[model samples]
Target: MTRLPASCSFTQALVNVINVLSGIGLLTTPYAVKEGGWMSLTLLIIFGVVACYTDILLKRCLESSPGLHTYPDIGQAAFGVAGRFIVAVTLYAELYAACVEYVIIMSDNTSTIFPNTSIHIGGIYLNAHQIFSIIGILIVLPTVWLRDLIGGVGASILVVLCLLWVGAVDQVGFHRAGTTLNLANLPIYVGIYSFFYAGHKVIPDIYSSMKEPSLFPLVLILSFIFCWFICTGAAISGFLIFGDSIESQKHANKICSLQIAVCTVVIITISKYALTLTPIASGLEELVPSKWSRSYGVSILIRTALTISTLVVAMTVPFFAFLMALAGSLLTMLITIIFPCACYLSILGGKLTNLQMGVCIFIAIVGFLIACDGTYSALIR
Candidate 1:
């Protein structure tokens, strides 16, 4: 029953896109490339295009179905129970993925603060597992306690600050000689880079918040263009400055002085993203109620549980590259491929021309293949 304000403008809508896309992915891009190589960059461009196509399709669906609010709503309208299930699965997957990613980032940061304190048990050394768990709890509790959109914005601002800190460090390395791009490294880096730039799932929210939804396409186009340029620059800058030393950049060990500063910034950014994910988890919990049904206590308990779980994973695994890849694969499929094409098909009601349907189908298929490839690679690795 909560109604959005009518006063929200097109600029505000664009800002939302910026906020959602500007997260740990930006920081992780360099590391992802370390794993996959320069092919990551090509994938980044490809995914960016896919993301935009999906965004437009999602916007079109929203305009066509005025009553459809959330992603789930659009799914339901398009494919009935099956669609609803797909959306439900997608949303929860995203929530859990976000949680895991955030926790891992946080734990990594914590390791920097307490380097010698490896594992703690009952007055004995535990293991990396225990340390991760502890770090996760610490980060989750504080974040869960401040669960709200406003809090999310605060978290995002922290991320922005971290990016700024990285910028400063990059400046320090500016005087250092740059490296040449290895043409052989393009594929993997492109893929990883695309994942970093991808952020189209929330387009409907952006448009809905706008005073003029009609202007949304233009706004999205411009905003994504900006994001693309920024990401490309960041990738080139990090690669040129650090070269094969990019892996070391993950721990920020190469620049020890900037380590704490960079990690703190990254953690803050990711924490904000985790905060944004809480609502999705809460919504999922609503689908199956237990003794805690309709109880305010249940809400608190569920939120707390999710936060703690996320923190534990973050602390323990601390595999930033893996989590980013997983998130990229799953979310890219849902948002960039499936949802948009489904929206178009549903809205058109099979009445579209061959060319129109062909385009939608082609995009959907391409997205599906990329997602599948990414997911397969992630799991086996």
Candidate 2:
């Protein structure tokens, strides 16, 4: 029954949504296109349309009950306590996976800048990627202790502009015409595209924060439209510039290393890593008894532990594209597509027409299939 203060303006809400949707995902779009070929850009468009529809579905669910504020609140309203737990876990896991992606990005880009760098500490050797990853974790640790959010919106957009500069102003011309399609790898593209539109878990919070919640739908629409173009532009331009050879996320970094693309990615990842992990850290703190959790030392301990864990995962499974695909297919699919429809139908079934019910069921089915397909594809790769 908790409610957020109504403070966000329409423009603020739009910017917030765009920021969340256009994270490290933008940098990976070309790599995703390379994975499944140029024809797979259709998946990006398809996912954008469907994910936007589900955002509306989530809004409808929130409107059905005034008590709903957070995503878990919608879940509790839809199917009670178990529903809340499911939504909360899925959302947190997705955020944590995103943190891992951030670390991997920073590490990859750092290595890109200093290709032969390495370090040795206590007789244990660390290569450039591992050393830089540890440094990234340390750099972001202090940000986790702060309460305010300093996100990476500008750096992501800067990356798109950098791509353009690399292709046009620089000599990296858009001459490589890629293949029309490749069915075998399309599932990987699905997961990555699914990752592109995964801001749904925060929609309820954004709606609650709005000065006029009714304008929330407009915010969602505009946000999706804007981000769609950004993702599409990056994909089309990156693929054309780099072609099929741009097979991994690191290659996206390689696209414009001279344009300080790696530097931008490093900055974006560093800025976003703590902001992304803070919610999960706060959630864990809430689990401890109030007196202990309120202690400054305890809070720092929890946040640092979380950051270190993500660094370990980043170092262990360092394949950025495959990991992102796995997270998108397994986590983003559930959060952005399946659960929203399920909750909407559960909460508002009585008011819906038969067509509405059928459509929800159909969308849920398609989301589930994509999740399974993409998860398997990502894992095997």
Quick one: best lDDT, which candidate?
2
In candidate 2 the C-alpha lDDT for residue 97 amounts to 97
Candidate 1 per-residue lDDT over residues 80-166, each given as its tens digit: 888878876776676577667655555555455555666545888855445745655664565564445432334434433444455
Question: Which portions of model 2 miss their true places by more than 4 Å?
Answer: 1-5
lDDT string, candidate 2, 1-381, tens digits: 122347988888888888788888877888877777777888877888898899889888888877877899899998899999999999999999999998888887777677799887899999988988998888888888776665757878788888888788878788776677888787777888889898887788888899998888788888888888888888888877887677575765575465377777877876777778888988898999988988989889998899899999999999888888999999999999899999998999999999999999999999999899889988998
Write down the TM-score of every candidate: 0.82, 0.96
Predicted model with the maximum TM-score: 2
The alpha-carbon deviation from the true structure for residue 187 of candidate 2, after best TM-score superposition, in angstroms, is 1.2
| Model 2 superposed RMSD (Cα) | 1.9
As a TM-score, model 2 comes out at: 0.96
